[model samples]
Target chain A: MTSDSSSTAGSPEENATSSSVSGATALQDVSEYSGADDDLQKEIQTAVENLECCQSEIESLNVKVAKEILKVKQNYNKIKKPIFDKRNEFIMKIPNFWLTSFMNHPEMSKIIDDVEKEVLQYLTKLEVEEFENINSGYRIKFYFNPNPFFKNEVLVKEFSLGASDQFVSESTQIDFRRGSKLRKRLRDYQKMISKAKKRSKKSEEALPRSFFNWFVENAEDSNDIAKYIKDDLWSSPLQYFLVSDV
Target chain B: MTSDSSSTAGSPEENATSSSVSGATALQDVSEYSGADDDLQKEIQTAVENLECCQSEIESLNVKVAKEILKVKQNYNKIKKPIFDKRNEFIMKIPNFWLTSFMNHPEMSKIIDDVEKEVLQYLTKLEVEEFENINSGYRIKFYFNPNPFFKNEVLVKEFSLGASDQFVSESTQIDFRRGSKLRKRLRDYQKMISKAKKRSKKSEEALPRSFFNWFVENAEDSNDIAKYIKDDLWSSPLQYFLVSDV
Candidate 1:
């Protein structure tokens, strides 16, 4: 009976030890899993931050390119305004002067119908498109009904005009008009340029490194350029522009 | 006599010791002077190196500004070309077309003598001079003519023309040549642009920061741009651009 009791005690003790050991193992696994979860969270946060940085870079680049294009367009407007107004003056004279000259020659009179159709096809009162397409040495119908003949025949002359065909010859002339489409397009172009200018202004603030710098000696008021005896920039603005690691 | 001899011998020993000390002091001072001369030489070398650094900065600054100005000019040229061409074509037609219209009018015929003289007075083959001067609205003279019509007469016309009179006609017409000068100027402008482009090509290599930026993404045959990218510039190109230092 004693032997039987001893064996039974041994079994109970062994079972208790085994159960405790298994519990310890399970606890360890839980702690390890928690540690892994923490690492994963950190990794996710890092990735998110990196992605945001990349996104910001892309946005600034987009705005910068847009602004530069706008500047190009603005300079164009300065020149284009004067040129466009001048173009209209010349275009308006085309049909008036040309039709008058064309009515002079018998040979050109036969081709007047064809030339009229050609001129009208490209002539939609939008002067720019027409002038751009006019070939320098190309032939066209010119009319010279010198004797107050309203319905005079036109002469198809080979017209290779430089900027101005000085003499009053039977030459191809223009009659340009300001069309609604052209007016709208110009307005749209201007609006885009203004928007780009605003975007660029915002981007300039975002690019901290692009600011003008003062020397170490005159760094008292780095914010104000006047602090520097020589307020001019020290180096190219490009030197400061940094790209975060992609 | 024994006491006296003892005192005299002691005094002689003291004197010899004092003389030795004095001689050692003199030698120490001479050695220190030599050491100080070496230090002076080192200081001069340092100062010279510093001066060289400052000079380099000034050179870099001048080069960078020049490049930026060139870039701006190039941008201007792209827009300037097309518009300028159009302006010339338009402007050249004004003189002759305007004059003919004025002369053809019955009312204008009365003061044709006065009109012709007025034109001759202000008439200039130089475009720069002509564009700067604004024409009055109207001046007429019955007897004053310059175009081989009338020799000397009081010439006056009562026309109100301001700065834009050449562009928009008011009362009288004038005869003139258009287009040639405009075209000629355009040609000259293009030539200047080409020279600028050549200058840009030479300078593109001098700016390593600019070159790296330009070619880091886009590869081109520009050797300077390529060199800047591949080579590690130990000394920053920007240090040389300082305009002044305190």
Candidate 2:
């Protein structure tokens, strides 16, 4: 058995070459035989096992890291919930917060329908998802409860904060009710934006006109709203109120 | 009145100097007067108002951004909860999984008490708190249910992922009951670690000793436990596991 073990232990290739040797005897030689061959085989086995253990430990560590990330996310949400709920409540009380702001922008005013002002309401929620350094920007989803005016309740916009041209795109798939005034207003608004883009291009600034920029620029209403919108409870979403029906 | 308005409108300084002028006359001159002074005053007023509006709009936008961040955090938490719960369920069922692996580690075996093995159990939960790009690391809080061994049910460890020396520290405020064997074990473990640190320092490799490193290194087991601890569900706190009944 000793001689057989030494002979078999020459190399993995030699082990295979000993075709006459039975499988059970070979395994016994490696596991139980008293020789340097057995020690070498055991060391190899332990090393292989250690390598496997290292891989598994790393995999386990990764899972743990992922779990930690989720936990951190939950903690952030826990801290943010009450503040967000208060914001939502305040927004709900004040009608047309988002819409008024959207229209108040210098550029958006050119495209938005004046008549649609009466129909607009406050956004139910606005959520911004950050992609961190990889994207260096955020995407926001605005939610509105279903109303009589438009069926497309959700509006999504992606902004690349790092880029010179910051606006990426915004989309909303509205389902206008049959014979709704919004259907006409939507068409008119799209045309207005297209015209604005063309007109601005012809002028000194050839850059493609951004509707978001226009909305931000035009949304300025300083008088009564400014005085009324005093900075209050650090939590309440509305530090100041803007006076507008639409 | 026109001449007075022009005189007053020469500069904002002039307007201030003409304090002797009657309020009604000044108002009358500014509003009903002719020439660029009235126009200049009105333009100035409008510009100031617009500046105020711009500031307020920015404030409003900040609040909205905060709200959006909260919403995104909530979304991440919502997605993570179920997966975490499932992982908890699975981890709860596997008794002594952590303890056996810890003991299996050559370094950890030098420190962990043999008697304490029977009293050990799996962790109930782990939570991470993120500091984002500023700190760029996470702090984890581990929760363990009340058990017979010790009173301090929570253990916290902070890891700075970016730093060259990553382990910050681990702490636990354990209140041992009188005549408890765990008190001796805890003291012994601490002493063992201190001694190990001293001994390792004297040797050629003066690498700082990390308890976390011992836990991580020794927590590796390549047998059935490795296969059993496959990565499937993503949320489970990997920490010290308690041994089964002796």
Candidate 3:
């Protein structure tokens, strides 16, 4: 994990200015400091140095903390993977299992539109696989039975943390079938957004209305959906699978 | 940490209802189930049981994860404590150190009112001490010079995690001095709110407008401020102290 280092140091001039600005206003009622107090100023400089040194030590310890946390995640993942695999086998036997689970998940359901809901009927399995490092990231694989919408058997979305520890994703292309209703709707939506953009210079980019659009959209966009699937939905699909009862 | 058990299991009748409800709407386009498919229904039940077993295993693994995470925090705290102690010694020598640090912090600055700012000028040393278990909780101690606002030498606010992993806090009594402006302001504010409540039934509870009010008001309220102090502000006070320059 990349630690923010911008605030680790400041120029002497900047430090002096900060001290005067904060000190003057905050210490107005308290005893005033004469500008000639060299010893006190030196002591404050020493204190700031010591504080920074402590911060460095803490930051290094944080690196160790991150490693330990990753180890814990890796160990737990190793234990849970086989169980998840067995659970997936059982899940595959149930008709409309993945579709029903998606609809029951609060965060997932919000992103899924009528078109996506229609398409998800053919979903056979949804698997989330974390990378070997665990810290690097994970990929979501969506397997489908023969469906009217597309030729692809599986659609995958993979998210990885970049060198700077930012999330970036890559998604598989969907081979939409000829005369696909979903494809036509997406094209019409794009056309309308382009027309709007021509009319107004400040018009925003087209937002994804359907889950498939969201899946194949921007690889560098916010990874909230990926996090939802990996962290919440994948770990406890049964929980969401039974949500509609209550 | 307490895990949510509400979604762990469902009654057979309820599970049957859930499957039917979700199956009916989400699987309308897909092939319909005849309801007389006893073999399929039995398989679904078995699958559900297996999935529930997986959930149980995951839940137990989570208990182990929590223990390991606590160990990581404890290890880091042990390495960081002595450095923090040395840093605190140096911090005590600097005049208005706590006040300056508080004012520089983004979240802390927002809660500080003019009166609280004036009172904080008397703040000599502010120390945050985590409980021995680290997971148990922490306390924020504010050491003050003899001032007109308060007679107490030090004010302490302690937060602890309850048996069910809920946060609860306890604060020391503030012994207000004669003709304390803060005490009078609070009384006037309460009187005004009561008057408003008498006039309108839909009136809401008075929110704490000052940092001092936030400290002594409700011990069981949201612990966002405590988290901000312990997790963000305390770990790297110098980072916030130098924020203004950037």
- Which candidate has the top score in DockQ? 3
B60 Cα displacement, candidate 3 (Å): 1.7
Q: Docking quality tier of candidate 2?
A: incorrect
The local distance difference test score of each candidate is: 0.28, 0.39, 0.67
lDDT for each residue of candidate 2 in B1-246, tens digit (9 for 90 to 100): 000101101111111111122333323433322444755556533433342343344344444444443344445445544544454454444344345545645444444554556445534554454434212233455566677655667665433332332223333455665766766655666676567668887666533333333322222121112112211111212322211111
Please give, for every candidate in the order listed, the TM-score of chain B alone compared with the true chain B. 0.26, 0.41, 0.73
Query: What is the per-residue lDDT of model 3 for residues A10-118, given as tens digits with 9 covering 90 to 100?
Result: 1121111212223332233222344627787666666666666666666666767767766876887798788878878988987777788788777778778788788
lDDT of residue B239 for candidate 3: 59
| DockQ of each model vs. true complex | 0.01, 0.02, 0.32
Chain B global fold similarity (TM-score) for predicted model 3 against the true chain B = 0.73
- lDDT winner among the candidates? 3
Provide the DockQ value for model 1: 0.01
Off by over 4 Å in 2: A1-78, A97-112, A131-136, A160-167, A192-202, A205-237, A240-246, B1-246
| Predicted structure with the largest TM-score when compared to the true one | 3
- Model 1 ranges with Cα > 4 A deviation: A1-228, A231-246, B1-41, B92-246
Say which docking band candidate 3 falls in: acceptable
